[model samples]
Target: MKEVIATHSLDEVGKHPDFGSAQATLRWMLIYMVEETAGHVGDLDTRREVLDSEKG
Candidate 1:
């Protein structure tokens, strides 16, 4: 993925039919990837807190 991104401009557009009909540029994809990763991390952290509290 990094290599592909490196070869293209940030303005380069592509389709993500699996996600939706709307097309997104490389910049948008990168931003979405970061946001999704952060959201998942937050979810895991919340789950960890719940489990730790239950252990008490």
Candidate 2:
């Protein structure tokens, strides 16, 4: 299900729907990409913080 959603989202990201202005389409794509990247960055920050806090 996750893969299916990702695939469908990528397909839409490429098309740039006709109803929206070019800048609006680009903005939407940029927001999605930033959000996806932020999720990964948050995960990495969490792991690093945990490692630093551990008594090793």
Candidate 3:
């Protein structure tokens, strides 16, 4: 999916529906995914550190 997105042209992006264009939709989705994933990772890391500290 990433490779397919990288190769998509401006014209192809413009053809996307539901968000004015494919690029706009793709850009927002990527931003949202990254932020959400980062938050989850941070939360998991914090929990792991706390658990390890308690065990030590």
Candidate 4:
């Protein structure tokens, strides 16, 4: 999924000399994690709403 692609991109970037800095890697990893979590949360919320409506 998108996570796999993002993980691969992070791995690739971390290996490159230009983005090899520890700070940069950490920053990007944090941002990526946040974005991924947000997407998951949104999906979970949508499912929860659907389930709630069905239960009503």
Clashing pairs in 4: none
Q: Rate the local accuracy (lDDT) of all candidates.
A: 0.86, 0.64, 0.67, 0.67
CA lDDT, candidate 4, residue 53? 75
Per-model TM-score on C-alpha atoms: 0.76, 0.49, 0.58, 0.52
Which stretches of candidate 2 lie above 4 Å from their native place?
A: 1-24, 54-56
- Tell me how far the alpha carbon of residue 33 in candidate 2 is from the true structure, in angstroms, after superposition: 0.7
Tell me which of candidates 2 and 4 scores higher on lDDT.
Answer: 4
Better of 2 and 3 by lDDT: 3
Q: Candidate 3, which segments miss by more than 4 Å at Cα?
A: 7-24, 54-56
Error of 2 at 53 (Å): 0.6
State which candidate has the highest TM-score.
Answer: 1
lDDT of 3 by residue, 12-47 (tens): 433445656335455666667889999999888889
Residue-by-residue lDDT tens digits, candidate 2, 8-47: 6443534446755544344476677789999999888889
Per-prediction tally of clashes: 0, 0, 0, 0
Model 2 lDDT, full chain set: 0.64
lDDT of the structure predicted as candidate 4: 0.67
Best by lDDT: 1
